[model samples]
Target: MTAELRGTWLYDAHVDLGTPIMVGPTPEGVRAIFPVTGGRLEGPRLKGRFLPHGGDWARIRGDGSIVLDVRALVEADDGALIHLTYGGRLVIPAEIQARVLDLANPDPLAGDRYYFRTLPLFETASPGHAWLNGICAVGVGRVVTGGVAYRVYAID
Candidate 1:
């Protein structure tokens, strides 16, 4: 069954949160520029794919596309569950690394503790960046109001 995801409010929130208003060149020429054009809500889920613009930044850059797919489900007045999955790949030269899938409960206790569950299901197209595996951690945080931008800190 297809789920209805909503992203308007959160999209605005991301804007107010100062979600990088510009697309700069990638630090690594091999990487694609992110958050391209046309990112919006597909119902209750936030779905978007970004690609590097055609330029010097897009040269050595591989076919690695940045994928952002998220689903939001509200639990209570102040609690919510967000399921997110994202991945990047380099198809041309065949170099992929740091593929991550993390499940986060931003409001586990609905107020007190935040929790995260990470699946061991991760792989790299090449071993050159395999070291990224050991340094990965599933993180969870609550969006606290900072009067300016959205602030996310470890809840516990």
Candidate 2:
């Protein structure tokens, strides 16, 4: 099947958003850790997965998947603000989970406070001439603030 994002206006449009996603300074420079995987767009739904940093690797025994959904809506300042939904278990130990209540919430945990803030706008390699169907970013934090560095990734 042809890649959904190929030549789709969002390709470059998303790039313009920026590189080295900004994140707030937290303990351990830990805010800058996001793992992205499975970025494939299906029909009206965009799907992907995100893995937070410092989480227990043992928790993700098998191939883990986080659900992502977005619309084609793009704003002038925000670029493409597609609503995202993440679903999956965090790798933190049960003891840690008890303390970090925020781990369950995708938005806050996926931002600046913990490890999510380090995400760059583009983390996946472009499937030549194809639109991205699914994309995932992993990390732990609260509020993906401005200040954290980012690194842009583009597949040729």
Candidate 3:
């Protein structure tokens, strides 16, 4: 027997960031830092803007897959603060990876040549949004023009 997975749409996150700071090849992978400037989140359950000074620490592994470690904050309409943290992986074929690295192209990842997914955790102290603290969430992400977009869902 198999169990079906169900989830509710929690939020859509649009994150803005500066150019990645490439750290060159490391023992583990090619490291880079993407500075998160600011952005917004909109959905039925929560709506807010991302706090500044947060960013994603990404690593392009030896196999060309990208690993992401991100941290940020969301302030709901009611002023409740939710701390967001997630780790994700971006898997792409070698041929696609080569195209994505092309500097001449406007949008290297303009097509469906990759898969990006994440597991997100939320933390909050406000009573109104305290339910987030105990929920398990996941997200599907894509590389957008300026940054990245994620459709987050709460597992039910």
Best by lDDT: 3
| Shift of residue 143 alpha carbon in model 1, Å | 28
Best by TM-score: 3
Ranked by lDDT, the better of candidates 2 and 3 is: 3
lDDT values, one for every candidate: 0.24, 0.26, 0.84
Q: For model 1, where is the 10-residue window of minimal lDDT? A: 147-156
Order of the predicted models by lDDT, top scorer first: 3, 2, 1
| Ranking 1 against 3 by TM-score, winner | 3
lDDT of 3: 0.84
Candidate 1: count the clashes. 8
lDDT of 2 by residue, 49-143 (tens): 22222111112223222111111221222123343333233343344333333323333233222222222123223343123334334322222
| Per-residue accuracy of model 1 over 54-135 as CA lDDT, tens digit each | 1111223334433222222211112222222322221221221221111122221221222222211122332442432333
Per-residue alpha-carbon lDDT of candidate 3 for residues 1-156, written as tens digits (9 for 90 to 100): 978999999999888777778998999899988878888999997899988868888899987889989998878888998899999988878867756644344575753568889999999999988889999999988777667788999999
Q: Which regions in candidate 1 have their CA more than 4 angstroms from the true location?
A: 1-20, 30-80, 88-156
Q: List TM-scores for all candidates, in order.
A: 0.18, 0.23, 0.88
Candidate 1 is scored at a TM of 0.18
**Residue pairs in steric clash, candidate 1?**
4-44, 5-43, 5-44, 5-45, 6-43, 6-44, 6-45, 64-89
